[model samples]
Structures are given as structure tokens and as C-alpha cells.
Target: MSKLPGNAGVTVLGDKSVEFYRDPVSFYGQRMDRHRGRVFLSRILNRPTVFVCSVRGARELLCEKSNIFQKDPTDLMTNMYGDTIVTTNGEEASLLRLSFSSLFTGNSLESTKGYVTRICEQHLKDLSSRGQCSYSVYKSLGTQLVLGLFLNVNPDEQPELYQEISCLCTQHWHGLISAPVNVKVPMWSSGFSTALEAREKLMAIIKDKLQNDKHGLVGTLGSLPLPDSSSASQHLLLFISALIPKALASLLTSFTLALSGNQQVETRRKAQTDADYLGFVLLEVQRLWPPFIGGRRIASQDCTIAGFHVPKDYGAVYISHAVHRDPEVFEDPDSFRPERWGERNAGQQHLLCSFGNGPRSCIGVKLTDAFLKEACMYLLQHYDWCVDPSTQALQYKWLPVSRPANSPTISFSRLDENPPGHSGS
Candidate 1:
């Protein structure tokens, strides 16, 4: 097998985690160009890592050779979220997936549709009343939807409890990004320590819900065939965490910006009326701007990804942003062309890694898809929107959730309702 193109520099001194975290798009883009290849070697998190930026390599790493390139058990996710499906490996992971899959798919998912519709309408119907809206507003809406669906914590009905849990979730999420050290003193405490405290409080709340609330996902999850008593609570914490909401808000914001303004009025109109076209629009938005930069895996055995050798114990990361734009799979990669999904890239949704691919793909994908369509359709039906300043910087910051760095605001005008079901077309 051929050696990877780039260097896996020596240990901590050579670690490029800081640089990668700062601007991962540019970091990987520069190396991909320099190596003249999509798959290259680099040091990240103080490990000899192989960076996979091509669709072929990603497919091989995450799908075909997945057994050899496995999830890292010692991943930061484990410390923050506990021994949940996200960080487990082997049979344990498989079992957890089997049990939880039932909650997020099929009838369990269909039941959430009514709640999704009501939440979308409640949050989106008044966009024009405010004239302009920012990312935070959508994020709040996302948070409410997640908490309400997963924990039965409705913001409208139990505003106090919702706000408290929301604040705790934010604190808990901060630990995922902050230093791993956990320390506390009389006057000073690390973010990690505070996060741990928040986790305990959230866990208490979750445990109570699981015991008392005999309805919704929480109730059903409490009865699942899990390995241990704590499994249900741990997984509930993962679901109610701030991460999903941020991701939901990220895509919603990108969708708004992508089709905004008079120039794309026809496109917006088409998306509203044509469900397939709306799907294409959402797909394009994700392809160009994925919420998460990528996911990481470790080589369990010697393996080849897109013809590059990855030795056992080596780290492998797939950059969704880079993989989606691979010219071999996506023509005119950077441009937003919804038609491409219907034409050249037809039946190629499998190639995209926005929610990842293969067996380990995000479990909530179906639920996420349903919620996004409902939210987007609400916006399309209620108002016509455009970037408030039009010239505002729309550059994205990837880490912790991908949204514009400046949090661009958009102006919305209520569509005239002369005829029933008017679309302002």
C-alpha cells in the first residue's frame, strides 16, 4: 500500500489541533492543494492522523472499511456525554443503536409531526412582525422543539423549567469545547467543572422525567432493552443537549440566506410549491455549508482508504465541507445549484457526509429532515425575506456549530393574503 501524501509530524510539539480548530476549511483546503490529493496525512489531537477529504476516501473509511476504522472510545464525547451510543464501539454500540433506532424512526417519528408543525408555526409565523430576525431566535425555536420532543419540556407550558434546562444545557455544552480539566475552588471554577455540575442537575431532571412522565420519547425510552439502568438517562441527556438545536439553527439560517432576495424569488416560489424542489434546496444548502466540519475515527487494523494506507491506531478524519465539494462527484462545487441534485448528481445523496454516511450516520436524521421541511415550508408560506443589509459579511465559522460569524439578520415582509393559500409569487 502507498504511504499517505502528507506528513504525520512528531507528537505534541507538532500537533496542529489549534490551527485546524481555528479555520478547518482553510487548513484542509491548503493541504489538499499542496498534496494534489484529497487524502493526506497530518497531526491532530497529538496523533498521527490521515485526513480524508474525497468522497471515495470517506466512503471507504466510513463504510466499506468501517469495521477496521472504528470509533474512538476515549473520544471527548464520552467524558462529556457519558457512555452513550456516540462513543461506544463494537457490540455495545450496535446494541445501543438497535434499541434507540426505534425511538427516532417509523411510528415513533410520525407521532412527533403534530408537535413539529405547531412549534414551527408558533416560532415562524411572526417573522414579519419583527421585521428582522437573527440566528439566536431560530436557535431558541430549535431548543424548544428539541426539549419538548425529547424531554416533554414544553417552553410555552413550563416556561420557567424550560429556561432553566436551556441554561444548564448551554453550560453543559460549553464543557465539550472547553479544556478537559475539571477543577473548582472557592472563588474560581473551570468551565468543565461548571458543566459537570450542570450535567448532574440535568441528569436529576431527566431521571425524574423518566420515572414520572409515562408519555412521549422519554417514557418509551425508559422501557427500552438497554444494557444498564443508566443507559436511558445517558441517552436522554445526549438528545436534550444544546448540540442538536445549534445544528438545526445552522441549516435553517443557511437555507434562508441561500434563497433570499428578489433575484431568487422564482427559486423560492418553486421550492414552496414543489416538495421535490424544496428537498433539492435543502440538500444544496447542506452540501455547501454542513453544520459540523467532520467526524473522527481510529484505525483498528491496517487498512486502505482510497488507496492510502492507514496503519493501526492512526486517526482518520473526514471533512464534510471538502468531501461535498469534490469536483469528481459535484460539478461546479462551490456554487449553489439545486438543479444539480436532479441532473448530474441524481441518486447521489449517499455521497454527502453532512450527517455522515453508512451505518454510523446520525440516528436522528429522519426526525431532523421532517422538522426542517416543516420549518422551511412555514417560512416560505408566511413571508418573503431578504438579507437586511445585503452587503453584510456572510463568512461562516464552523466549530461548535456552523453559522455566519456576524449572525446576519434578514428582513421579512408578510405575503399579501388576497387569495387563499397565497404564496406572494
Candidate 2:
């Protein structure tokens, strides 16, 4: 195999973690230009890492040779989520997946649709009246959905408890992104430390739910054949995390922005009426604006990805943004054209890594799809929206969760008052 294009650089001072995290798109874009290839070497978290930015490379790493590139044991996800499936590997991981996936598929999943619709209607019904909405507004709706679905913590029934858990989840999430240092001094503590404390409180709440409330996901998870006693609680914590809500909100926000304005009037009308067209619209939204940047793995043994050599123990990261835009796979990769899904990219959704690919793809993807469709359709049927001020910046930040940097305010108009016209007809 050909050697990786760029140098991994020296350890420590040569590490590019900060730069990569700050703006991974620019980092990979500049390097992809310099090295003239999608696969390259860099030092991330002070380890020699292979950055995969092409569709072929990502598929090879995540699908064809998935076993050879396992999840990192020391991933920050493990630190925050404990020994949940997000960090586990091998047969243990498989077992965890089989056990937990039951909660997200088939009957269990079918049961969530009604709740999803209710929550979407509950929080979204007032958007047109408010006249404006922001990322946080959608995010709150998402938060209520996951918290209620996963832990049975209804915001309306127990508002104070719901608020407390939400705040704690936010703290715990901050820890996942913060420096791992556990320093504490004189009424102050590191974000990671604060996150751990928040985790403990959240765990207590999760445990109580699992015990007293023998219903919903918490109840079902408690009854699963998990590895150990703490398994259910740990996984519950992962499920009820702020991460899910943020991701949900990210996709919803992107969908709103992408189909906004009079220009997309015909598109929105079609999507509202045609299920396949709406699916295409959602697919396009995910393609252009995936919630997470990408996922990381560790090379098990020496391997070749996209024809480039990757040494054992080396970190491997796939940039979903770049992979989805690989011109080799997507024609006019950067444009917002949902019809491309119907034409060129038809039946090729597997190529997209928005929720990842292969055996290790997200277990919660189906549930997420159900919720997103419910929320998006709700918005489509009830209201039409556009950026509140036409001149507002719509630039996006990819980290933590992808959304407009300024949290662009959107003006929503009830469709009943002002129906969308069929521009083409």
C-alpha cells in the first residue's frame, strides 16, 4: 500500500488536536489540498493518527475492514459514559448492542412514535405565535423528547426535576469536551471534575427511575440481560445525555434553514405532501449538515485504508463532512439539492456516514429518524419559516453540535394563514 500522504509529525508539541478541533473542515481541507489526497497523517491527542476524508476511505475503514479498526478504549466517551457500548469492543460490545438495540427497534421503537409526535406538537405548536425561534428553542424540545422517552422524565409532570436533570446533563456534556484534568481548588473545579459530579447526580436519578419506574426504556433496559448490575444505569445515562438532544436539534435546525424562504416554497410543499420527497429532503439535510463531525477508531493491526498504510494503534478519524462531499461520489457536492438523492445518490445512503456505517453504526438511528421525521413534518404542516432578518449570517460551527454560529433567529408563519404556492405549477 502507498504510504500515508502527510507526516504524523513529532509527539507533544507537534500535536494538532487544538487546530483540528477548532476547525476540522479547514484543517482537513488545507491538508487535503497540500497532500493532494484524502487520507493523511497527523498527531491528534498526541498520537499518530490517520485522517480519512474520502467516501472510499471511510467505507473501507468503517465497513470492509471494521474489525481491524476498533473503537478506541480510551475514548472520552468511555470516561463520561462509563463502559457503555460507545466505548466497548469485541464480543462484549456485540452483546451490549444486541441487548440495548432491542429498546430502539421493532415494538419498542414503534411505541415511541406517538410520544415523539406529541412532544414535537407540544413544543412546536407555539413557534408561529412566538414569531421567532432559535437553536436553543428546538434543542429544548429535543431535550424533552429524549429525557421523556429514555428516562420517563416528563418536563410537564415534573418540571423542577426535569430542569435539574437537564442542567446536570449539560454539565456532564461539558466534561466530555473539556480538558480531562481533575483539578479542584477553593470553590472552583475543572469542567471535567464538575462533569463527574454531575454524572453522579444523574446516575442517582437514573437508578431511581430504573428501580421505581418499571416502564419505558428504563424499565426495559433494567430487564435486559446486561453484563452486570451497573450496565443498565450506565447505558441509561448515555441514552438520556444532552448529546442526543443536541444532535436531534442540530438536524432539525439544519432542515429548517435549508428549506427556508420563498425560494424553497415549492420544495417545502412537495415535501409536506410526498413522503419520498420529504425523505429526500431529510437525507439531503443530513448529507450537508451531519450532527457530529465524525467518529474515531484505533487501528487494531497494521492496515490499509483507501490504499494508504495505517499502522497499529494509530488513531483513525473519518470526517463525515468531507466524506459526504467527495466529488467522486457526489456531483456538485456542496449544493443543497434534495433531488440529487432521487437521481445520482439513489439507494446509496449507505455511503453517508452521518450516523456512521457498518456493524458499529448507531443503534439509536431508527428512533432518531422517527423523531426527526415527526418534528420536521410537524413544522412543515403547521408553519413556514425563514431567517428572521434576511441579512443574518448563517455560518455554521461543527463542534459540540452543528448549528449556525449566531443561533440565527427564524420567523415562523402558520401555514393556515399563508399557504405556500406551487412555484413550478
Candidate 3:
């Protein structure tokens, strides 16, 4: 079969790279009408890649034929996390997921709801204390809450470990992932060595915590009744490294969207009705600005997406930006309209690929949703926040996690701080 149309070389890849870096928020929509269902072949960071921008393709790759598909992290990623669930596929991944399944549902989910509220409230209080919080600050607060809820890290009480791990995971990943290539460069030696050492130290802290008790619903494996064939410490490391970036990005995106939306605090408090406007806001944000623009998966045996022939072990990257922007699926797909989600239930909701579709869909969804709801509720219910009117529209960097490249400033005022019947922000 003829190769799918795309920028596999500088000839085709050049424009996409430039635009993605230059303007992320509006870039996808600008090209969506022209590129939907098109597979663009390109080399990213010198690696050959295929970006399938179709919902059907993503569903098949991530779900329908997931049996043959597998998780494939970079060589650098393999070094940091050996065989944790995030790195493994097939039975190994299942066991790791099973070991942690107890924490995903039932009593565990019910118990963690309180922590969600408390963490959001505390973080907002901290944000308010620093009146001029930027986009980066929101991400930091989200990361802190992720740790507090999952691993039980008390950042205030243990600043060293908290700050150290954050540095290693968030700031130092590029150095760590490039260790092999940088080993021969004299100037890169310090960063290369530091990455390895930091990983070890961070793992030690995580192991100690998991062996003791789970911070949120991630209870110790030993305490659970299910059979666990995985190392809880390594699993914790996998999740900690994997989840932190997405956690930060999602918070930034959701917060940015909420501040931009018309929904009010009083409007959100009355939940469980047909018109839960805030929930719609969250879904629409994910649809328009997913934390992860793309995800990688390997072809199991063989498959065809939109007439594309993908052989076994062939690498594929599904671009969510393409999938979510399908005009056939989403009307006025480029615009932010939260009300579209009001009537969507579990059945037709599959049309949205914000979390991907099928077996390999993101596991962090439930927790992510919880955190978003908690954060949104806390912000809207207790404060009036606004994006600086002078700042440019939401533009982001996709790598690591999708966040505003410029780090724009946002202001928040507690409800009580305002005069009675004060309306506009």
C-alpha cells in the first residue's frame, strides 16, 4: 500500500514542529478541517513516528486490537522504570494493574473524596497567600495534591524530599532521558549522573512510603486481599513519574478553561442535575486541550487505519488533537462550548477521545476527574478567579505536559473578600 500522506522528513515535518512549538492551543484547530483522518508520518527527536489523527484508528490501536498492541516507552524511560505496569504489556501489565485495582474503586474511592476536598482547599489557600499566582503555580499545587492524595507526601512537613523529587521528575527528565547520548559529552556529565542518582534516591523515599501506608486510595499492597505479583514500590515510582506531568498539565488546562468560561460558583454548587455546567466545562477543556496530544502504541499483528497498512510491531502515535477535532463528530469543533457535554451520557460519550477509547485508555481518568472537580469546586465556590485581560489567548507546549509556555498570571479573590452582590470578576 502507498504510504499515508504526512511529513516524515524535514519537507513535511518542518511546518508541524514549528507550529506546535509556536502556538499549540490554536494550531490543531487551524489544521483540523484539512487533516482529519490523515496519518502523518514524521520523525520526532530523530525517531521515526506515525501520527494517526482519527478516532477509529485510535480506538483500534488502543482498544479493539490491544492484544497485539503494547506500551513502548523510550530507551531512557525503560532505564528509569524497569518493568512497572506503565512500562510492561500483556500479562505483566495486567498483574501490576490488578495489584493496584483495589485503590481504583469501591470503599477506596469513597474514602478518598474527603482528601480531594481538603487538598484542593489547602492548595487554594496557599495560592491565595501568593496573590500573583501564575500558570506554573497552579501546576505545582496540582502536583503537590497528587502526591498528597496518592503517596501521602506532606510537602510542608518534608520539604527536602518533596522538592528533590519534584525537581528530578519534572525539571530533570530531559537530562535523565538523554543520559546515554550525553555520557560522551564532558559538559553533560553532571546532569547525566545527577539524573540516575536522583532516581535512586526518589525510589527509596517512595518505597519507604508504600511499605508503610498509601497516602490516598493507593493503599499498601500487603493490606489488600487480592494477589499481587508486582512490587508496590516500583509501581509507585512508575505512577509517580508518569502521573505527575499529566497531573500538572491537566490542572493548567482545566484551570485555564474554567477561568475562561462563563459558569459561576452558584451555578456549579447545584450538581447532579441535567445542567451541570461545570462538568461540561471540564469535558470541553479536555476535548479542546487534552493534556496529552498523542500516545504511542505498537501494532500487534497487523491493522489498517483509514486504508493505512500497519504491520506487526509497527509504531503508531494517535494524535488526540485530530480525533477530538473531527467536524463529523463535534460541531463547531474548534470552539469551546461546554454545553455540548450536557446531554452526553456513558453511551454516546465514546465519541470524545479525551481519555482515548478502549482497554488502553488512561487509568488516571477517575482520579484526574476527581482532582478537576475538587479544584474547580474549590475555586468557583470560594473564589473569583480571572485571567489577566492583557495576556494572550491560551497557548501551550505539548511536550512533558501541555502547559502555557509563557506562564501567564491569574488572580484569585476569596468570596468573602468581595463586597455583597459583587457580580463581575
List the lowest-lDDT window of 10 residues for candidate 1: 416-425
RMSD of 3: 4.1
Model 2 residue 42 CA deviation in Å: 1.1
lDDT of 3 by residue, 74-149 (tens): 5466666666656677876676566666676667667778877876677677554566566566667666766666
Q: lDDT-based ranking, best first?
A: 1, 2, 3
Give per-residue CA lDDT, model 1, range 1-425, as digits (tens). Answer: 89899998888989999999999999999998899999999999999999999999999988888778888888768988899888888889888999999999889999999999998888888887787888898899899888999899987789999999999999999999988889999999999899999999999999999999999998898779999999999999999999999999999999999988878888988998999999999999999999999999999988888988889999999999999999999999999999998999999988989888888889999999999999999888778889988889999999978999999889887876425554332
Off by over 4 Å in 3: 1-3, 7-37, 44-48, 73-75, 126-129, 175-193, 211-219, 223-230, 245-249, 261-275, 344-347
Candidate 2's displacement at residue 93, Å, is 0.7
Per-residue lDDT, model 3, residue 199, is 71
Which pairs, if any, clash in model 1?
Answer: none
* Residue 350 displacement (Å), model 1: 1.1
Candidate number with the higher lDDT (1 or 2): 1
lDDT of 1 at 352: 89
Off by over 4 Å in 1: 417-425
> What lDDT tens digits, residue by residue, belong to model 2 across residues 1-425?
89888887897989999999999899999999999988899999999999999999999988999889998888789889989888888899889998888898899999998888888888999987887888898889989988999888887799999999999999999998999898888989999999999999999998888889988877787778999999999998988899999999899889989988888888888999999999999999999999999999999999899888888999999999999999999999999999998898999999999988998998999989888888889988988788878899999999978988999888888877773462211
Candidate 3 TM-score, true structure as reference: 0.82
